[model samples]
Target: MAVTVLSVNAQQRGNRENMTPEKMAERMTEKMTEDLKLDEAQKQEVYDLNLESANKRTEMMAKEQTDKKAARENMKADQEAHEAKLKEILTNDQFVKWEEIQKEQREKMKDRRGGGGRPQ
Candidate 1:
């Protein structure tokens, strides 16, 4: 009984892993066709467009992520420089306000990290 269960589980896992990208694309196309009210010609056109869009999106997302990473590094360097300047410029009372502002900015960024907050 245990052997049978193990075999079945292994087969299921293999089936899942064996799914081709073409099959996945076909399934996605079917879903999109249903949602978009696509006729046969329209479906083909939309599928082609969607595939193109998906490729473009993938490329753009990768580049955007790279840019974001680089920008974040630059911002960190800038923030460090700015903080040093601020420390030199601000009195004790002004420094307290600066700290509060930093705290607020952190809270705002935390809310935005998951895409629920305002535009970055």
Candidate 2:
């Protein structure tokens, strides 16, 4: 039973690692649609934004193999651009809720890292 559980966990992790930008965007869109009660247009726009962000992240991950600092800076810039786009696309209330969601996720990540936050 333990072996089966471990194998399933490993397989899930592998699947996540290999997920395409479209798949990631779809998942994010679905979640955001549910959380924000988004309209069809909002869902479509969010999906596009999410796909673009995912592709940028994938590219940054590749770049990180060669230049960690440069990759980090590029990632930050990309994130800021994405956030700007999101602010433009989302309603003010939705944007505030999105920020709260992001803060919650960051807190969860910090907890997962034993409260250390990101390594500098």
- Ten contiguous residues with the weakest lDDT in model 1: 52-61
Model 1 residue runs over 4 Å out of place are 1-67, 112-120
- How well does each candidate superpose onto the true structure, as a TM-score? 0.35, 0.87
Candidate 2 residues lying further than 4 Å off, grouped into runs, are 1-9
Q: Can you write out model 2's per-residue Cα lDDT over 1-120, one digit (the tens) per residue?
A: 999998998999899989988898899999999988899998899999999999988776665367677777888999999999989889999999999999999999899789998788
- Write candidate 1's Cα lDDT for 20-52 as tens digits: 545544665686455444568655654554454
TM-score for candidate 2, residues paired by index:
0.87
Best candidate according to lDDT:
2
**Model 1 steric clash pairs:** none
RMSD of 2: 2.1
